[model samples]
Target: MLSNQIRKYTTGIILIVIVVLISVLLFFRKTQLNPVTGKKQHINLTHQQEIELGLECAPDMAARFGGLYSNTDIKNKVKVIGQKLVAVRQVSKSPYQFDFHILADSQMVNTFSFPGGQIFITRGLLKLLKTDDEIAIILSHEIGHVMGRHTTEKLSGFDILEKFKDSTHVITNYSPNQINSYITDLLKITFDSEEESEADELALKYMVEAGYNPKAFPEILEKLSGKSEIPGAEDFLNRHPVPENRIENLKSTIIKYHKRK
Candidate 1:
């Protein structure tokens, strides 16, 4: 009886290991070519699906920030700058359609983009921007996020993470907290900083192509770095890259861009 029990336990472990290996392999196997970046990436959603998801979530996102900004001229200006960036060949040929919006929130200095191309800048962040080109810097960076397909890649990551978590839980019978800790330690992913750097690099290229001043890159980073809301060292693991590192990376990328020109 003891021998049979041991055999059953060994077989269960083998099955779980096979399931985990297959899951990881399947996750890595899912790939699509990113049009703008010209690199292959793992993504679970089609361009149309990403666009639909963005459009569906945008209204709620704006509402959370007290809806869109009310100034017509400001709205038009932001839209035009975004259009100029999108018109750059690298961006123009991409599958995403870009739309820019200004949020009414004047206290939060933030800019972000959704999966497809729904980009937003809070009024507080806009107020700090001193020029149209500065605006372009922010918009282009968000454009980079969209073009990079970071959101869908994240979605894919989560999907695989859930599967792995389920498989492990079945094998170990770990408590919820233990499983959470196990997963966190198993994959302490730090892709955000890399993605931020990529976006900054893309922004530099797009700005130069679109005829925006690359000088504004550092200027805006400097201004943003001074903001109280910018992530500090303690927030490193939880938030986006610290502004100081981003400024340094931006400077190096700008130098590279100038050399290319």
Candidate 2:
């Protein structure tokens, strides 16, 4: 009887090992070439699926920030700038439909993008920007997130997939209990320093191509970074942390951009 028990335990361990190996293989096998970077990345969702997911989730996201902004003129301005940025070569080539919206929340200085090009900026952040170029810098950065497929790439991570599997289900099918959690997960989906840096670079490239001065980026960074020093700006600081090195890198990128022009 003891020998039989040992044989069963060993077989179970082997099965577990095989299952883990297969999961890893399947995860690694789902790679697609990034159009902008020209590098292969592991992405489980197709471009169409990303578009569908973003479209499905956008209304829920907008609702969280008190729905769309009220001012007609400002709303049109944001959309015009976004469309111009999207018209640039680096971003226009992508198979994504871009739309820009201003959230009604006037107390939060935040901006975010959904996969396949649904971008949003809060009114608080919008008011802080001084000029059209500054606005372009912010919008272009969100566009960079779309161009980089940062959200989808983050979702494809093995550990993230495990944690969000239930939420992922909610993404496709509405579950009253799980809806809030799914939106929360989307809010928490932020990029690391490296990814942020790439987005910054892409933002600069788009800004330059869209006929906006790339120099506005440094000013924009300084303007946003200054918020962290204020006591009541915790919300802005959390969502948009601007470290000194990022500014330094932006400066270097600007030099390279000018050289290419």
Backbone clash pairs for candidate 1 read none
lDDT of each: 0.73, 0.79
Per-residue lDDT of candidate 1, residues 164-241 (tens digit): 322312222335454344333323433477788888888888889999987877766664555545533222223345
Summarize candidate 2's per-residue lDDT along 155-222 as a digit string, tens digits: 76534234343232223554544446545776887678877887888888888888998787876677
lDDT score at residue 129, model 1, on the 0-100 scale: 78
Which candidate leads the pack in TM-score? 2
User: Model 2: clashing residue pairs?
Assistant: none
TM-score of 2: 0.82
Q: Which ten residues in a row have the lowest lDDT in candidate 2?
A: 162-171
Each model's backbone clash number: 0, 0
Best model per lDDT: 2
